[model samples]
Target: MNFVSTRGNVSKIGFIDTVLMGLANDGGLLIPEKVPQIPAERLQAMSELSYQELAYEIFSYYVDGEIPDNELKELIEKSYATFRHPEVTPVQKVKDNLYLLELFHGPTFAFKDIALQFLGNLYSYVSKKTGETIHILGATSGDTGASAIEGVRGKEGIRICILHPHGKVSKVQELQMTTIHDPNVLNLAIKGTFDDGQRIIKELFADVEFKNKYHLRAINSINFVRILAQTVYYFYAYFQVAKETNTKTVNFSVPTGNFGDIFAGYLAKKMGLPVGKLIVATNENNILEDFIKDGVYKPGEFKSTYSPSMDIQVASNFERYLYYLLGENSEAVTDLMNQFKSEGKIVVNEEQLLQVKKDFAAHGVLGEECLQTIKKYYSETTYLLDPHTACGVAAYEECNEANDFCITLATAHPAKFNESIERCDINQTYPIEISQLFDKPQYLEVVEADNDEIVRKLEKLFSFSTR
Candidate 1:
């Protein structure tokens, strides 16, 4: 199936082009012309497949013969082999009706690894086939930068630059990106919030000439492929949990920041997966939660909570969801987005707001409540949640019905956020993977919020610009 630009200013493009183009030239996100629907029987049959197997099934509909089935299968296989768990994303029964989808089994110990691994391999595959060089540009609150770096590091014909908010992310998270000594990876600590880095990245992509000249691509959820790869775990987790609980529908509690993760769940629900409700769990930065609960979409002051990743003023992926919520009226979507940009807010009508409530439920968890959730689960059970996942658990506790089978997406390993763990005063030890990070020499350029320095850096460091 061809992908179409959400803004309606660009023609329908193939999956390969969509993957490479990333942010559409029209300054809109790419979405499928039509989200493929799976028959109940077929979807049930897919339930028995492994994580990689299920991914191939879901992805084939979007890959749509542009890549051969065998080649696609190989790509899926190679990508997931990096995961340490037998079930790449394992479903653990934390209690009777509550389950945790462990997504930190891959490299970087965060949920982003699941998609970045595939995207990195896909980039290499495409580059070798077409003899094209690429430079992947993205902004990260915490985990995404390291995951994306691990994905494309040292690969021929591919270079990646990641900009993160300086001193805003956790110590471990900062070291994860800054300590990576790969020649092709450039890590910048922008002197601002994650939103600042994100805005600069988007500004760079909006420059069509510069985007082409540098062969810039996105490794963020703004890339349709990342969202596509993420959907598989929801399906896999559903199948495993449903079979164990003998339940047909299972709700997912996702710790959301950029709206990309929950949007994947929305895509799954739209594709006819028996997804009950996508719980949009937020930290103190509750722009998404507020908008979902009410129709008011406005950015508030950025809060540097324990969950720094969720501290975003403007979610880059929210526009894609806006496109669908407006029923694919590209003109209206464009108009509303422009208004949100110019006015810093967008309010929906009562009718539209009701339709939104039907799609997902939202709740915001405070910083102290999040830590308490972490402490409660760790003390009561064996599972230790990271700060972000604690937000999901907190929201689930506050918003879940007694009978609903809920799966909280464990977005990161607890080791990544020692700040929260320490605050909770819990007895826990980090893995060697985490403790060893302290010994490595850190490296990153601290830059102002402007794009000029970034542009100059990319130009100067086009060839192994490690500095």
Candidate 2:
């Protein structure tokens, strides 16, 4: 259960420390020192268990009793209690050989809630054990901010600061993060792209003294716990399909910007889920799509698309995948990332590129294609998809070469993107949780990308909020 930095320099650590020390000191993503493998029969045995049970079984491979079993179970129960659906994430057949795994059943109505809720509870446990407060710093394009806020809002011994790209997210997405009045939740609408905000967080974390002084932690998928929580759903979706349809193999199409969601699917495949293809779906900001399809990792202008959440040119979690793709050679990953940072691009060797293509297929859907997918799917199956989910569906339809059935991860509720839904001549009645967000007064600060100014503001805000 020990974890190591992807750069191969940092010392090995356990799960809890990895969770706390987000980005590795060596400027690499943390990955399990040894990825636990399961046999197909063992994975199938997990099908009969409930989501909570499945999660417990999967986490056992990572936690290794870091948190006592009973306490972990309690946290899991508390985290999932807020989900509106009996199945935290339900799988529905949208068409023949095409399914949608609905993941927006939690309080924040985004896939992130599943992980953030667990993380929030975990933080409470950690704070009590160490008798120290933690400051959570994260950059979100859309859903992560709201979900992370909801996770730690009003919780004791923790203060969360979320940075989001101002005016780049959907109205509901922005409102979800901005309207929260929790004194412990500090929302910053940065006057830059999500990549800028993300870069700021990484820069701050890379500063050893500054990171230690503030006890900075992460809620992004960069945190291994978030990725672990997300892995459960892939198993859940696979088992759910196995139970009813008896499908042996399934392909997952995940609309991802940060690479966390699909990376979870990749983990499931590595852990021996009969995953045929892990489809990396993207909007106009298709750095991931281009990189996976080709061997070149190049940065481009961050395009604001209908799917604002996917409007990211840089995918942070890609490093973790590179750890696996490069034969677990951390030095190679470190060199590649350093090159990408300095040159704004990195080209992989043919062998490395071939390895990437074997496990994952990537495609980018344009804004118009996303909108049309939403309208077309609604017309055919009466299934309303958010722009992000629409991109997933469109990618699957356009680039699917697998013979197995497809399961597109519906990352968010359509109600969260009402304007995009309306573009398809549809009106959505949001749930009471979302509808009430409009009535709440927003409390967010605007800041530039300067690290010192942002840190100063955080210090001032922390003092004010704590007092």
Candidate 3:
């Protein structure tokens, strides 16, 4: 499966090249030229396979020719071996017709681990094979910075610099990223919001000369590999829910920030998975919710809520979805994106809005409402939710009218956001792995959100010379 840019200017490239090259050279996110379809027989056959097996099956479509079959299988197996759970991502029945797809069993205790672990190893594998030094850079809200750091901490020849919003993320989230002292990892808490960091990351990547000089690669969901890796769980979760309930279809409620996770679900649906309506759950920063519920996509003032991760006005991955929404016409995608950048919003036509509404549902949950959902779930089902997942749970409850069971992605462990949990009068026994994080000395540099200032810091921080 060859990949092309959403802007449609870049030449077609294979999977390995796509993995190594994060953002497209033409300043657009990468997408497969074609999405592979899975027939019903294949879906039934896949349900019986283990998580790793399912991953290999789903990943093989895009990843077939570049990486050898045996090597890819081994790589996927090695990545999941770090997870604490036997099932890398398991499902918990919270109540009848409602479930939590637990996705926090990895090294850093967040869903980002599912993709980063594999991406990190893939980088190392490629670096070893090609004898090239690989430098990675990206911005994160909370969980992604830590998970990306955890993915490549002491791995040789792979250096990553992560930019996060200073003082905006939860304390545990901050500690998770800032405490890592690996020379290969540089954590910068930028003096702005997640949207600022995201913008900075995109701006830096847009400079083709600078990007090529540094051999820069993105670790963000803008990296199509991460989004592709993320789609496996949607298939796995759908298979599990369908088999258990004897239903033909199942819905997923994903708490979204940059629209990455839910976009993965959208890909799964396109790939012929019986994925019912994908609920795009958001916190106070609800640009995605607004876009889905209404035809207009406008960025409001960014609000920091209980779920800091979703405190993003600009959803970077939204551009990829827009490509498909515009009939995969790269010219139209380019035009709309240019308009969005210049005017700060994009509105869809009635037919385009109708098409999107067919595959997705969206809602914005409030801080107090999130807290109440956490309280209610913990009090009733004894299942604790991080603020992000609480937002998903609330949305799932609000949007569901189907008979089939719905799975809400439990994106991060509850312990990662104790500040939100505390407001619900809930006391959580911190995981032994997590409790040790507070004891570590943090290593981070505070920086302004300016792209040039970051470029200077990154040049100084990186140990290797440019290729």
lDDT per residue for candidate 2 within 6-34, as digits (tens), equals: 99987679888998998988888888988
Ranked candidates (lDDT, high to low): 3, 1, 2
**Model 2: CA > 4 A from native:** 464-467
Candidate 1 ranges beyond 4 A from true positions:
463-467
Estimated TM-score for each candidate: 0.98, 0.98, 0.98
TM-score for predicted model 2 compared with the true structure: 0.98
State in Å the error of residue 274, model 1.
Answer: 0.9
Candidate number achieving the greatest lDDT relative to the actual structure: 3
lDDT of each prediction vs. the true structure?
Answer: 0.90, 0.89, 0.90
Model 3 residue 424 lDDT score:
90
User: Model 1, range 373-408, lDDT digits (tens) per residue?
Assistant: 988898899689999999999888877788999999
TM-score for candidate 3, please give it.
0.98
Clashes of 3: 0
Question: Candidate 3 lDDT, tens digit per residue, 411-442?
Answer: 99999899899889988899998899889999
